[model samples]
Target chain A: MDIVIGVDIGGTKTKIGLVDQNGECLEQTFFRTQDFPNLTNYLDQIKITSDELIQKLGKEVNILGCGIGAPNASSKNGTIENASNLVWKESVPIIEKLKERMPMPMRIMNDASAAALGEMLFGGAKNMTDFIVITLGTGFGAGIVANGKLIDGYDGFAGELGHVDMTLGDGRLTGLGVRGGLEAYVSATGLKRTIMYMLSKYMVESRFRDVAYNDLHGEDITKAAEEGDEIALKAFDYTARVMGLALANFTAFTQPEAFILMGGLTNSGKWIMEPLERYFNANLLEVYKGKVKLMYSKMEGKTAAICGAAALIWEIQDKPS
Target chain B: MDIVIGVDIGGTKTKIGLVDQNGECLEQTFFRTQDFPNLTNYLDQIKITSDELIQKLGKEVNILGCGIGAPNASSKNGTIENASNLVWKESVPIIEKLKERMPMPMRIMNDASAAALGEMLFGGAKNMTDFIVITLGTGFGAGIVANGKLIDGYDGFAGELGHVDMTLGDGRLTGLGVRGGLEAYVSATGLKRTIMYMLSKYMVESRFRDVAYNDLHGEDITKAAEEGDEIALKAFDYTARVMGLALANFTAFTQPEAFILMGGLTNSGKWIMEPLERYFNANLLEVYKGKVKLMYSKMEGKTAAICGAAALIWEIQDKPS
Candidate 1:
């Protein structure tokens, strides 16, 4: 049997797993990302954990490569360059360190791009040559696949769909200091802000009204929307409208076959999906009408992160440098 | 000698030329586009004129192919699908008809895509893999070249950069009926609207105040800006700010090595370019700072259009279908 090691590095936790071609995660473990103050410490931990896995299972299965996904990572040089969420203060040449530990082919890319590769290889977008995968977590991020390959721009920053300015005037201030970006309106943080704005603008009283602005999260709105809370429903509606419109704008540029949605916001299921579909179709150009489909990611929870990491290596292996 | 025939179809004139491998236009001629009210008539005239050119120079040179450029043309199907600017009311199977007459390898591409290929082949972008060519004429159009190829997407409309929504609210209405699109602001037509908006918003007095709205063109503002007219200066400044901001936004997505400007607006020269360069650099992400260059198209006037059309054939000869 052959397998690839998939590693997803988040601010709080890092997940490592062995993934097969069928998109199965055979075995997995986790460690605290914050504990590693620098790249050396992080690589040391990765080495120890991987060695333990190899000792137990490496005898039976051959390891192909290691695929890693981290915030602000560079695929070209395999470096995590100034990821704000990570404790590493400067650029970390993680691939070089990983090579020293295992002497294997290893690559790193932005987490969102990994997720897109995951979808193309194992999830909802297996058949799609041209489509976009948008992840809605604490923030919104996207990966573009055009011509059956990742649209990794010259700087490996091709699919910053959420960063596009959707606001004409004063809107939400993004962490990047730009205002009215789609991420500021569609992500978990953006959803909470929408709830707050709905509370003030419509004076809609519902269960969500009981939640404080700072204390609120994406789950609360999903919970309330399930309970048929008016404010919660309104908030999702607003989020969907903005999401749909942004997808329309995006379609004019790439005319993707579908947009696969992933992340915590997807918990609301049809509540968020229906309006998004309606508005996306409505805003699309007449020529492109009823063409681009909106789909939910088939890869869920830990499966998404693990499969995406494995797919990263599978994707670039055939690419011409 | 080897040559390709280039045909650029515009609203007022149809320019046809013989382009050699060296990017030289050996000979050129024009036909009144208004004279051909139907596709049949247009093709009939094209066949006769081209046959004449072949008879005169066929012995001296080898004509490899014919490349045609027009608005609303689809490269995938080689058809002009309902070009609003053209007299033909339905889809025109242009390549099929042109091939029937010439019996040589022929192709059709969106004019902007042809321009991008032209730049890569003959203009300033020969060595670059990732770059964009923007034609700012009556409308704004873009052609994206990444990974040493065009980003043609699933369909052929991959590089409609001008249609991106720049305004959060109702700013300007595009021909496509979208509001505040980049095309509605940065184009030569958009520049005139900016002037009109400036006149209404600032109530400024300048030479441009006397020109009727219908009579005003982009050159008037360029002429006025040269004379240091306050209103015209403000208009170009405003247009540059919007254009630069849009390019900055585009850079985040593509991270091209440069953006080559073509079409009538380039005639404004440093008046439009200096501000565009200033703002494009200012708004780019920190990593992309000073990386994307702002370049003027090397081909000028009819040369750009003719070379672009010829380059369309040259481009596809080596591409994977």
Candidate 2:
């Protein structure tokens, strides 16, 4: 049996899995990323865990390659650059270090791009040649596909859609210290800010008024909206308006076939989708009106990230060299 | 000798040139586009004029194919769809009609896309794989190249940067009846509107106040700015500010190596360039701050369009199909 190792590196935890060609995860394990502060030790642990997974299979197996998805990873340089969330704050030469211990053809990309490739390979965008996979988690991120290929851009730093400025000078500041960026108004943190604003602006009764700002979470807002909270619904509407208008502008750039939503914020479901769909179409240019579809990612739960990482290997393998 | 027929179809006139592989025009001629309101007659005139140009060359030349650049033209469908400026109000099946008179491997694309291709084949972007060409004529248009290919989008209707919404709703109305689009702020007509707005808003003394809105042209503003007319200078400042900010947002999309400015408005020279450069760099995300260069088109004067159109044939011929 031939298999590939897929690694998904998060700030707090790291997931590793043995994924076969059919998009099945044969075995999986995780380790605390913060525990291994040193880069070399961290890579060594990945090798050890991957070997343990193969040994547990209890049969003859061939290791094809490895693929990794990480924050701020550059596919061109094969390094992770300025990933502030991680303990290893400097640029990590991940590919160079990993190759010495567990050698095979490997690739690394930003997590959002890996998820897009995952969507193209084994999810809702399987048949789509041109589409965008937007990951709306703690922050906003996008992976663009056009002409049936990922837009790696000149320096492999493309698809930084989160930081794209949404307003001239009068919006919230993003993590990058930029004001009025898309991420400032469209992410999980953005939703919380909106709820806070609504609480102050409107005299309408809402459960959110009782909760402290830092105590609130995206799930709490979603729950409140599910219970017909006015402030929560209004927050979703405001976020949807910003997202829809930004997407309409993005449509002018690539005119993609569809946009697939992914990550934690998508858990809000119809609260976000219904309004986003309506605003997206309403803001589009005349020619692109009613042509683009909006949908949710089909890759479900824990295995999705591992499968996305593994899809990177298949993508490279299938390319005409 | 081998050559291709390059046709540049404008609203009022059409230019035809016999071009060789080296991007040299061997012979050229023109015919009034509005002279014949009928589509068939216009295409017939094109074929006749092209034959006359080839005969004038006075040599045995192998005609490779014909390539056309026109407004609202689709390279995929080989038709001109809803080109309002042209007398033919309906979608014109240009390739199908031209094939009957002059048959060969032909291609057609919108004028901006053709100009970008021309820049790749013959101008400043010859060595660049990723770049954007912005045509600042009476309206704003753009052609984006990423991963060494044109971003034609899913339905071949990509690169409509002109209509990308620049404001939430506070800006001017565009020709498409949309409010606050990039075209409404960054174009020649947009400059006139800006001048008019400046005259009404500020008590600054200027020559522009004497000129009515209908009689104003882009060059008039440029000439006035050259003489240090405060209102005209302010108008250019306002236009440049809008364009620079828009380009900053655009940079986040593809991270192109450069942005080449073309068309009539670029003739404003330092009146636009100096301030545009300052604002563009200031507004760019930190990662892309100093990486992207802004340049003017290397293909100059009337011959630029003809060369751009001819480059299309070479582009198709060179592809590894």
Computed on C-alphas against the true complex, the DockQ of each candidate is: 0.55, 0.58
DockQ of 2: 0.58
True contacts kept of each: 0.54, 0.56
Evaluated on chain B only, candidate 2 has a TM-score of 0.90
Pairs that collide in candidate 2 are none
Candidate 2 lDDT score relative to the true structure: 0.84
Model 1: how far residue B235 lies from native, Å:
1.4
TM-score for each of the candidates: 0.91, 0.90
lDDT of 2 at A169: 43
lDDT tens digits by residue: candidate 1, B177-232: 77777788888888888888888988767887788888997778888999988888
Candidate 2 lDDT at B61 equals: 92
TM-score of 1: 0.91
Worst 10 residues of 1 chain B by lDDT: B81-90
Q: Which sections of candidate 1 miss by over 4 Å?
A: A11-13, A29-59, A82-90, A97-103, A168-170, A315-321, B11-13, B31-37, B44-61, B87-90, B97-103, B316-321
* DockQ winner: 2
